[model samples]
Target: MPERKPPRAAPLVLDVNSGYDELNLGRLALISGQKTVPPGLRRWQKTILTPDGRPVVITCTVPDDQVVPHGLDNDFMVGLVNLCFEAGLPDGPFTVSAYGLLKASGFPDSAQYYRALEESIVRLNKANYTIDEGWFMHGPHSWTTQSFAQVNYLSYVRSRSGVRGTSVITVQLAPPIMESLRAGYIKPLDLNFYRSLSQPLVRAVYRQLDALHFDESTADGLVRELSAPLMAWGSRLGILSDRPDNVARTLKPAHDELRARGYVAEVELTGRGRDKLLRYVFGPPPVGEYPELALLLSARGVKSGVAVRLSTVFPERIEEAARRFDHYLKISSRPVANPGGLLVAMVQRPEDFAELPGYAAADARPGPPPAETPAKGTGKGRSARQRPAAQDELDALEAREEAKLAALQGQALVDWVLKQLTLLGTMKHFTLPERSQLAELVLHGQLDGRTVVREATRAIAGGAPAVLAVVEDVRRHLQVTHP
Candidate 1:
């Protein structure tokens, strides 16, 4: 008999904290359908001085300077992000079908559309980034980091192909891109509604709103439903200007439609003179303000005063408790006899969240696919949506880092990083996080791949009693022995 594998290390269980709504799992790009294809080699660069005066610079380049990608690419990237999370960050070439891409993106399957897919791939591959003095986590140890850390996406295009061919493309994600998806700093989006919205600006506005964080308390100690501060143009959409006159023209249309749809409790575009901005608030879901909380109660058939006490006595613990509940569900293979009672206990005992089966000890048992997912963007390759209102802060942060990278001359540094990662992945069993630590070492051209790998292998096998200790040993060895 074939040796039974331990059930393929059941895929990691995801709760609200690690899955679904907690993250806006997509790449950043303009949702607006820009008809103009950038003609030649296109490049963008920006630089910023942090409050502490550390300079961060970014630079990016794309093929055919005039035909920069817009919503089409954004739609394609969002589909990839979704795949990474759903597949538990599998070592890629994530497979996608051509028909699926067309359906998700609303592109008609035709020769013209096929060409569109071909161009998007070229635009993506030509895209590159460099950042000097980067801020985002480049690695667990530290290095010269590449701005476009995500691997360039790969796909196949053939002449006169539509919905008839194999309809499959394999996507391989870079270390940085995969890590960002795994990070919880994301928000939820309803892609179904996104596909239905025909207007590009509407999709743009939707991504903006969906990205706002849910803070129960204001900076002034005032409690409120939700609030977000957004810029009118510029980086938010990667187009137009934030100038006084340019702020309202295109945005007004999106603004009106958004409020009319009841997605925003309040979305107002108001700013004095050249400082145009938007303040958006969220409305409750259909069942009420806190649908997840409410449903859990209704399931347990709790008493009427329970909600009031929980809010009054332990208002602070509610959100964290809910997160814990989710984490609990992720680890526990069995159902709880009393979920409501368990939630209440969590509220009273918030510290217990850490004790739940988590990163170091999470059950990787495979489970069914997420229930009721929206169709994948246009077969294996395209997407179209008015977009959702959720904005990913991580995306925003990467944008900042990428912008700075684009402004700097750092190709040698970018190449060194690519080499280290390529070698490590090929030769070592280091986890993603572990690889990140090793990545930082590449910053100043410290150690060659062979040396680093030898150190890691030696430290891991050399009597370290635990994983954390082994990691620490590697870190120590790099600092003292290597450099």
Candidate 2:
């Protein structure tokens, strides 16, 4: 018998800090990249990436005609990360079971699900990734630079009747990667929660969110707030963009998906122009029945970091604001100017909160008092002479609120313009330059948001390229016709 070779010794080991290796970008995992395959025969051909704040070059290649394993495939790869730790993060041909893969993946035990697992394994074997940096040097098994895909090898029965359950697979880890795993080159993650998500982008987003700690650290050591420049954040997540609004449009659904399912507590977007800030407020990981107002709370806020601070100090007050505020947005016919600040105010003074969403009549704001017809030509005879002093006070209060109501409408209109433009921008219609000008108009009050939005909607019919011309035309038209 031939002498058996010992598992290769890793000269370089991975640890938390090394995760910040120039190539890895200080993230526990590279959460963003092209996760899914495009529909046709075109290869996933993004040849290079130079990230901001210190460019780190990453070279990518996927064999032509091979589907660049969908985002969902990553769930299994993450499972392998956890498995590596459990198996002592060794370097070699380690074996894992078909049953275990399916179970950890949260996929059904049905035959179809088994096939899906088989498919992901195949895809992983096919895709390749390379990181360029000195600290990220090559290992013995690699030719010169080791492909991330080079470290993996999987084999399993693919036919439906080939195996009933608990089939085994041999996984080989790169020597350097094994060393990194042993050195704790990983972040704590909610594996089960990650597997539960249906969308790949949402899953990837969750990893980014879960991996990041925020300003308000809880008593239990959980992170609840995150503040980062939108562009930096998108870059960290590997979003292919220099624009925050463009990035936001792609990540918005992930935020919504997380909020809808209650994994995220709240989220807010605020700041000036293209260099905007994004704040994500997290909640206790969903363990029981979720509150119905979670989405409303997540959606409502400005300077949300402050609002989250209030929630951290007084947790119950957040729900109170959400329950009442949701009612207000739905029925008040006006959007609150600064929902984040209002929530903090409500927490301090609880009495200001409105009724729940469905109770419109009970919660509606009072309007101005009814007018009297000059007392049948006797102008001097005050019709309100018989009315109570309380009515006069109420009328005054209603007038002040009426002005705020117009402010609310204006804010709502602006929000609509931003939302529409960002969405169209994602479709390639709204350019960064066009977005910059529109944002300036918004900041300067140079254009009516409602008008710009209507023009934008009309222009979108042709294609994204037409958006700029339309917006410019709208601006000129507004200056000449409406100014």
Candidate 3:
């Protein structure tokens, strides 16, 4: 028998999606270095400039019942997102045990830790944010305004023995972040390296630093050197003190830890007194965001841009496809004329390569094809008094959609939902939360996909507001019936 290589574990890195990373990078203070939040610090607002110096207002509110997320909440948030990727990035709700979350976050899975986890989750769930202008939409590659809770919803069900036994938790990630994640606006963070630091403050600082260093527009798509004024740095890291000396004192231990770990080559405080600026020269970045997959693709002569783009956009599928392609290349009866092109094709359409063992997971799971565009001038001359469609036409449309629903797999709900919105002429008017709610309904089987499309089509005559009303009614019905 030929010697075979052992299976490799997926990389232990958190793929921090864009806009959320900016929340911790100083636009909003989601993480705090303080062990306990000050009383009455429920709402805070700040105005910051975008990369192009456009002013944006960010407002963050913590519910009266729940405290602002602070301390170890950062670890929990990071761990939860990492778990999402590990589970293949399900687009809807998923269950994970509370103990599993604790372990993944580098905390001991004990009663106290479990309690801490529960409270942190609550805080995260109730935290509401409104970004008047700085939310980055990766699909459009533009900045826009947005409002959402940090988490959509969370349910905790404990076993009979409560803290002594396992407890399963269901979490729904917020919509805008999910959209950005799917759009591939992600940065890599070595979770193992993050958890290795001794101090919570150090870990928090390092998380922010890692995000700060990943600049997609830069030459290598990384900022090797970073500089910030002391006061602003404190705000970014959630350091409680505003005094220059106080901030410096609090940051010293974290700075020392980062330097000792060799992640930071040097940390310098330039200038004098309150005007002091802190600069960081970081050690080399990890190979590529998806190192193992990148290596396999590069070895097969794949171009760097193509490899990175595919890997970023399809992190879950690309790795599996690449591994299968590797095995196929080794066992094929004949040589591939263009190995790079072949691998690229496989990654893009894994279902076509299902005969390969590595692509088994992707079998029968083709992504939805792009929606067809209506020809120009087809609906261009319609007046405000015009009816969207005859009642009989809508009935036929509903019947056709109902027929399609029986064959629809859960993965296509988002696209199907978008199609309905597009038909109603309300796609641009719908908020992210509204779109997410409609998708979640179809995904969880709370509402039939056909009903969504039917209602949307029927509401078209009344314009976007009417379509919005139908969505709200569906959501309310689900809440009352299911909750």
Candidate 4:
């Protein structure tokens, strides 16, 4: 058989300080544009044995700096010896060369230093830190010019003799994965959006109560207390009526159902009613109104009639009641005002009226006879109390309802605007060219175009879009064969 060329010498592995420079050398050599590796040097290929006796191939460039001078500095010689030893050829017939001066400096023979260096090299190679620095001259003149010269060290040894092949496995945890691993998960609420909707609703209700001659402080207090549950109820039922009359009409059934179900009792114009009204005017309520309220009120039963009476006797109590009732009417007028003055009567104690002695008996007496007014001819000094302008009252009520509707429409528009801005913001993070292509695709109905447009319009109208963009995107991107 023809003599097979002795398996090419194993490629050199160099350990160097300047990783960037070494990497640049390899890159420049490939392009053949610059002399990163010194002149006269060329790449070579070789094979080594795996631990399991399989052959592994490697390729590397040979550099001039590997030749150590005969009498190099002890430290430099030690380093070279260590490098060769690490290549699995510690006891050499291994060639050593260096730049002119280093070769002239005497080599050191410190067994301890040599041993420690060898151990370190073994550890470094095991850690996969071996790197090659292209060859260059190794002399004081060369060092000053290039700072540090590169050296390539190759080894040839019996099969299965040294460190073998290694495979690295990497696992990357994406943001969602990391977040899922956390102890507790929560989505942050947009408080600014919450407040923007809430503040106006509260203020509008307060103004309405003020128009009805209710005390401001009392109206504010009542509105604040009921706002939360009311909004929750509205959200649940998806009730977004603009006019108070329509709101009342829409919610009356829900209120009646809750009352009939015994989840809520005495659906009076009290705290519970006020809260429901506030939520209706502002935002969507909770999923199921009765169940949620039942959970809240189960622990605390309704206030006693006696307690209600005592509270009403105080002028402050009457003012508070008026304020609460007015606010409810402004937002939703389902719980009508107490027409028979029952709330006022409940506040008065028998003893307080006893001071008047005959007051109770007089109140119990038969109704008073009708009073006679002066005829046109009599011309009495006093005139009858003028009736209110029905037209004017109706106009005022209509204006108030229109304002509320406008606010709802405005909020819907704002929400749509925010959604559009979010989509644009997402697109901005893409690479320039990619973003341009995506924009074009959006225009051509190939991206999130229709879906985004639909969502935007739905947000503004508080209604579903006529065209479903997500469905359209699915049809375009993932063609499906219909049965």
Candidate 5:
């Protein structure tokens, strides 16, 4: 009789506290749709700083669904794994907590839990996913730290059948290891030294795959045959080793490992394996596929560009409509417009109010003030005595107006900040100079701060047309200072 497979392990609940609530769950919610988040997963309000020092919130949650046989089915599990890698967690040791009602739901083997966890880690790590922290537990006495630590640190996890499982695994994205892999793959290719060939290889492979005349019946044969030539192409590009034997040996282990993990099978590529290979051989999917913009627009109930365009046209005297539009573009996965061309056009013929909706013709005739009657017994001399007192009142009113103007300037600064947050949801990669300039633009009622303005100008111009909208906004705000 065939050996019976052990049952799956119960779902392990994970709670990540990255020091920011937005970074925690809001960011996740932005990336993964709210539907994927387990029902009853409470998002606690909190704040944490990104590597770049921008403040954000952490998303907190508790598992609500029954543990699935395969951990991959759990959205939270996958999200956390992706987050860890994206946050560069593997560079150093870090600690996170996992708590939930643990019961043997599927796998009877107590060791299955460890196996599943380890497999997840390894799969992520081998895919160049970054994680550096060791797994630890401070729970009941039934769970021993020493045993868990030992099992967790192992490079691979073994299932009950003694076959190494690929559910979880962890590996360091150290420079030397990456260099070795690149050298081994690229050395045979006679191309000049270049750091990355994975992308070119992937594009070539994709084109090759697309051109093949194989049906499902012959797809397997095509894949096998094509792998050799593709490998040769990679070798010629200096992405593979010059030594044919060394290249074969190096690639064999990866093929075998992927095969064992069910990422790749004997005859056809599994969906999961295909995705992994695409990322590994290419890179992360393009920004056009980023989920945050989709989520924001969906949640804010924006069905089309009408609302956005209206907001851009009329910012309600608070935020600059153009700037807000630019913010939307920056946070959006959409490509940005070219700055040089836009600037040239803007300088050549500035946009007129006639082009904008809701712009009415200015009235040419002035209206007279209402007529005032003199009080009884009032004369020129008496009016002169009253002149000083009247002047004092007028002076006081002028002072008050000045104060209000200053206050409005302060508020504009604050509004600018809020507008930025609305655009760029907390991500860790913005530069310090950029942040400082953003803050200044809010407070000073100006975007023409020489260095800062130049930076903002570059940012707005480098990408989509939406950025131009933002540049226009900044220009309008700066007008207040100039006029």
Candidate 6:
């Protein structure tokens, strides 16, 4: 056999499900940042005010068998969530190799990290959470009460050989969490930037801060500043100390690191003693320093040096190609195995993609065209005589905007179904002709996509050829109903 190639490096973006972010925000999960848990602290309660100003309480219970998860556990959770996304966010139990998890999470494959990973998994499996109110349900865009364990069940094996460690880990994420994630309640995190931080405390703080800063509804107007009382902020972070001075001292290192890294423009502590309030101005490192092309390229796992070189050498061409690449990344059902290579190819031969559906001149252009300049003699931009004419134009504009939005939503649904099929291993079974036929059926609503995917996964798990079985079953159903 010829020499085998190494596995491709997965993208470093983590679509951090909002439910996890809320849990972290409310202090219901990812316990105190200290290296060691405080003795005899099995239970804790924290209350945070909702955006509407109503206060909600969160009660956390740590079982006697496991210690509260903290520090490195935060990194482990990030890794685990990325694994779930990589597996197409399975509806049931999914298995991941231990080595894959570590590398994805930026952990070294050593006995020390392995032991830490094992310990973190045990703690997560045993912890329980109850939120009396303010559990944001992403599916319905509403807040409600909930109680859950982060992990329903977990099983793993330990491998003695360090290099060839192929230990598998199986986990079932709780329904509430998975439902929210599937419902599109997630924000992208720069896992690469996150791993670059020096301290665990800093990483934890950055994740929490990022969750607060990113607003899905209004992408452009991100929350740029945050202020909280010193004591309360410390408590929210699960800092071990209660004293103000000690808390500030413990946090100083993290604050300094964040400032140096450009995640924070400034960190200020105002007032004195118990009255002090901490304030931070959010400053993402890439904001002013890197050009848009460089930022976009690096965010997708391209090396900084290459991204900078391409952006600087061919500013306009690279930007256009990058946007085209991004459109595919969003709409393609399968993850891009080699994003950099594909992007370079597109940049090299932009004309090859001219006929591609996603590379349309109008669609590739960011945002809608600027509104027509106001007609003369009308303060509101149209005279009384021109009302009908201008009204017709306005209606046309609105119709075009709505059409664009509907097309995007339709593409999103198709992508979702295709992703599910890929996860079930059904897509790989189809020949090119069958694949095209199935795609047509899926697009035309002839296929119950979710049910098919679910059943296909079950069939494959039971050692059956799921694709062939599904086809035969469909044929039988059609004959029974039509005959």
Highest TM-score among the candidates is held by which one?
A: 3
Name the runs in model 3 displaced over 4 angstroms: 1-29, 47-56, 158-165, 288-483
Clashes of each: 72, 3, 0, 28, 49, 0
lDDT of 5 at 287: 19
CA error at residue 101 for candidate 3, angstroms: 1.3
lDDT of 4 by residue, 297-415 (tens): 21222122222222321322333333333343455536545422332332222323234322223334446634647666665422332223655787898888556533432213222
Error of 5 at 358 (Å): 22
Q: Give the per-residue Cα lDDT of candidate 4 at 459.
A: 48
The RMSD (Cα, Å) of candidate 6 is 17.8
Candidate with the larger lDDT of 1 and 2: 2
Which has the better TM-score: candidate 2, or candidate 4?
A: 2
All candidates' lDDT scores? Answer: 0.46, 0.51, 0.64, 0.28, 0.29, 0.62
Structural similarity to truth (TM-score) of each candidate: 0.50, 0.44, 0.59, 0.13, 0.19, 0.57
Name the lDDT value of residue 407 in candidate 6: 50
The weakest ten consecutive residues by lDDT in model 3 span 1-10
Cα error, residue 417 of model 6, in Å, equals 22
Query: What ranges in model 2 sit over 4 Å off?
Result: 1-35, 40-54, 134-147, 160-166, 214-247, 260-265, 271-277, 282-483
Count of backbone collisions in candidate 3: 0
Alpha carbon lDDT at 442, candidate 5: 48
State the lDDT of candidate 5 residue by residue for 1-483, as single tens digits.
001112111112222221111111111121211112233432222332322234444222222332111122122233333222232233322111111101111122245554444444433332211111211112242111111111122232233653221122222333322222222110111011111112223222222222221211231211223232323333322232445445444444444543343323342222331131221222221111223432333233332222222122122211222333334445556654643223222222233212334322232243673344566677445555676898999899888865653444342333323222223221112233233334445455454323333344456445655455555555455455444
Better of 2 and 5 by TM-score: 2
Q: Evaluate residue 11 in candidate 6 and report its C-alpha lDDT on the 0 to 100 scale.
A: 25
Per-residue lDDT over 1-483 for candidate 1, one digit per residue giving the tens place of the 0 to 100 score: 001112111111111121122222232332323334345526655453322334556566655453555556655555555544544455545433343344334556576765666555556555766666543332473323446623366654343543222233445665565554444334445666665566665776566445433221223111223322234234445444546555556566776787787776776666576565656666653232344554454344333234333343333355656666777777889988877668766665454445665633233354663444346654322212312222456578678865654442222232223232232233233433334334334433444533443444444444534434544555675657445
**Candidate with better lDDT, 2 vs 4:** 2
Per-residue lDDT of model 6, residues 1-483, tens digit only: 001112222222233322123233323334566656666778777776554556778777888766666788778777776666566566566555455567656777687887777787777788787877677774454777878777777866554543212444667777777665554345446676788888778887888777666442332325668788888778766787779999999889989998988889999999999889999998852232236776777676565544544454334566667778888888889989978767755654566666656556643544664555666665554344566887899899888865653453232334444444555556555443344344445455665554665676677756656567985664454445434
Could you arrange the candidates by lDDT from highest to lowest? 3, 6, 2, 1, 5, 4
